[model samples]
Target: MCEEATRRQVGICLLCGLPGAGKSTLGRSFSATILRQRFAVITYDKIITAEAFHLALQDELDQSREIPPSSALLKTQETSQWKQHRQYLLEYLEHLIVALLNSSELRPPEGKCDGTWYRFVDCLEEQGLISSAGSSTEKGTHSVIIPENDEVCLVLDDNFYYQSMRYEVYQLARKYSLGFCQIYLHCPVESCVLRNKGRPVSIAEDTIRLMDKKIQKPNPEKNSWEQNSLVLDSSQLIKADDHRIVKLVNQAMANPLRPLQENLEIKEKDRAITAASILHQADQSIRRCISETMRRVKGTASAHEMKVAAQELQSAKSQFLEDLRERLCEKGIQPMTACNATTIVSLFKEQTDHIVQPFLATEQSCCLEPNLDCNDRASGIS
Candidate 1:
């Protein structure tokens, strides 16, 4: 293992926009002109090669025994395969970042990493970030080193049409306590389609139009996590000399995000309190219904008969509470507001009536029987 590398302030900058919105062009221009530090534009399109996507699609097809012969279904599968490639690219970037942070040799990813991983490593090597230096001491692995004192900002160039896609990058930044920022290239759908047409390998115009509808432009006011973001109109020429871009990068690097900390003790305590409140509500409702039933039958029945009925109701209440507790534990107790009193009272009344019905029937039978002694009837003898 290498000694700890210089703890420089590393940051991740995301270039997001629809295809042919000039994200890659802007990244190139920025990397060439940005001063005092190295910038590596990790383009997703290059990493997720055509061959890799074909294999992914093949795997998806192989997993399904029968795929319906529908263009829409095939398109959905293609999108899913593309997303898998995107995820793998993110993992590759994360692995690189981990190696840099730990000052360790760049080990190949374990378990099911395909050719794309090697291509990604080769891309970094080409940029002079990592190099081949395997020794006899280390067998069957690549030994690479990050250059000293190079505060590299990894500029991720991708068509992040969904906010969720960008959030995944932000989460990675937070996990490693790295500075993060987003740059969104805003271009009209028509202009993007026109620009895409000029390229040798063009994306479908319909796909770009679909992405335009789905794309979520970063709004700092709406999302606190996206405060370190900038939107540039790609219709106009964008240059690295732009002061706003410079300021945004500098500000993000200055302030790295802290990971969120969860307090399990507090959460458990809250759940316990909620469960207790629900149980208490249920108990009170059952007791109130039992008392009402006893009061309604008080004029016709003896004190001893009322005591018998009360015992039966109490037993049913205990069983109901036990079942309620078990339910809460299984499903997680809901909030206090969700525990409606009227609903609880109605349920308790229904169950309580069922429990007390037999006692009422016995009393009625005793009264209707001729030859039954008055003292025996008062005693509630059946």
Candidate 2:
């Protein structure tokens, strides 16, 4: 009848902010306070450093390799390579999740991973989340142990400055129907720079400042998927027993993300409704313009003249409506309200004047010369 006995709960917790924003500090607090669950904190900096070192060593061993001409160009290339390594880290985490879910051996897919994959595996082994499946003699045989208590949390500690980087993890959670949440460690740029100076492995102050400007903190109002997120000011010391942090994690684990599905039927139905609404509004606006135009010219023309002008205007309206509908719904050339009321009325009046101008002119000619027949004048022209 307990929570764990029912089903194992697994989730991803992202700790993201600027360097020295105390994300690692908060993650440790979370793991210590959150009871009756298995927790593993994956520190991205350590793995990234290992990968960078490997690349550096490779460059050193291969001295014949060509180097960039300028230091600026070299720095840019290094930044690009680091981005690739981050991508590989995400892929490695994805593979680990799959192995845990399937209760299978943790082996890299053929040609899908690089040196970063082994470092990731080593991190997991260090945390006791995975163990060697074969004897100690085997180098790469490993398997994930499904937690007995049915609750597991993987806290990813990194300076995920871009929304897209966090989105990748969200997608992974949705793919596996796992709970997902984020924690943003908010601190002044000055405070972060000061804190970075105190760490044994201090990052460059300029790099920390640059990341502070680039960091995109979680916004639930803007992004519905990031609803279960917590923001704590890392300038102040965070306690292990923070209520807000605890509540955020509990809510995420309670409601896991649903797997993605393409609902083509719903999408088609929505398109149909939108098309109908657009046409209906256009038809109503065009009809109102026609009625207003007729009212203005009512007393000026004879009844017969009015009747003839009305017929011509109705024909023009039909042609305009057909064109409008085709442009809006069929070809998707314009938005529903792209042509405002004033613009529509002005365009319709132009067509209306063209259609009814002859009638008004003919009527005026008949008034000036009573002896001449209006019918003869009209018939003789066409």
Candidate 3:
């Protein structure tokens, strides 16, 4: 999968952290202030914008600008488009990694030689976003501060919230025989929200809380990327050319990263089975909650009782997600993607009408048959 290379020091350096946790700030400072411009940055926002253009084109094919309903056809098409887009980005990033190592091979994935990928590559060349192609040892800009070599640090600036996303980048590093390191900026949810508020385009506070709940911390026991990572407290103001920032630059440059070894790899089918089993267990829990709520409320239940029962159902669903992640670890599988997890949760919700219809009917019965025995009512509801 990789050619022989003289350089393992020049490769992907992922800047991972929560939103407003100072990753973008650190990336800029490390490249411009610490290392003095011997690096190329590829931001995730531009990658998303590049792919969004193609999605915008899809509506034109139908000759209507109106947004479609959440139909199965639309979901399938969107999934396909994203899968292709991910592949294109991987190929593009891989090319940059190769160019950094001073390797001679430069071939884009077939069909991407002309489309969005081509234009993006040209833009990189024109703006010096990526290193000059083939001439790997050449100086990109007049930098008297940095060393002269084929090594140009590549900064992957993004909100890599999931371990799966980080793992994907780590796999790319291994695939091309290049050194890899991660800078995980750790800031509390409260701190990040406060900082985010100061931004011109602030994200919703609820969205930040939800991410705080879902974001997986780096675990060195499992992932190789975690071993060579830096967990920085980004809650404070970091000056330009701060010692912490300078130390990271020196680590990536002088100290060649040790080979990051993977202890396990997960397959797709097993992950699917894990997902299904999780939802099934969650369904059983919801049914139990409904049954228990009926027994407790007896023949005096109200909307409040129903609401309490619904809240129990939600708790079960959250636990099911946590349980599924642990199961993935035991079974050597990647944790479920956010899209797939949301789809499963939505499917369970679609069944909510059926699930709650019985509960509501029981509530109606409580009012209709006040004289009825509690045990008899519970049995009837069940």
TM-scores, one per candidate: 0.64, 0.61, 0.51
Q: What shift in Å separates residue 330 of candidate 1 from its native position after superposition?
A: 22
Candidate 2: tens digits of C-alpha lDDT, residues 1-382: 9632454567998998887788888777755684555777888877887445334323332333456556445555555677777888887777777666555566665665466777777888887788875534144557677564457878999877778889999999999888899988898999988988998877667556656655678999999898888888879888546878777778888888998887989977787777677667656766766676666668778898888888887888888767665655545433344334335444555656676565442432111111322333212111
lDDT of 1 by residue, 186-267 (tens): 9998999999999886776765776676678898999999999999999977976588888888888778888888899999
Q: Rate the local accuracy (lDDT) of all candidates.
A: 0.72, 0.70, 0.58
Worst 10 residues of 1 by lDDT: 364-373
Error of 3 at 109 (Å): 1.9
* Cα deviation of 167, candidate 2, in Å: 0.8
**Cand. 1 TM to true fold:** 0.64
Each prediction's total of clashing residue pairs, residues at least 3 apart in sequence or on different chains, is 0, 0, 0
User: Which runs in model 1 stand beyond 4 Å of their true positions?
Assistant: 1-6, 51-69, 135-144, 263-265, 271-382
Query: Judged by lDDT against the true structure, how good is candidate 1?
Result: 0.72
Number of the candidate with higher lDDT, 2 or 3: 2
TM-score of 3: 0.51
RMSD of 2: 13.7
Q: Measure candidate 3: CA RMSD.
A: 19.3
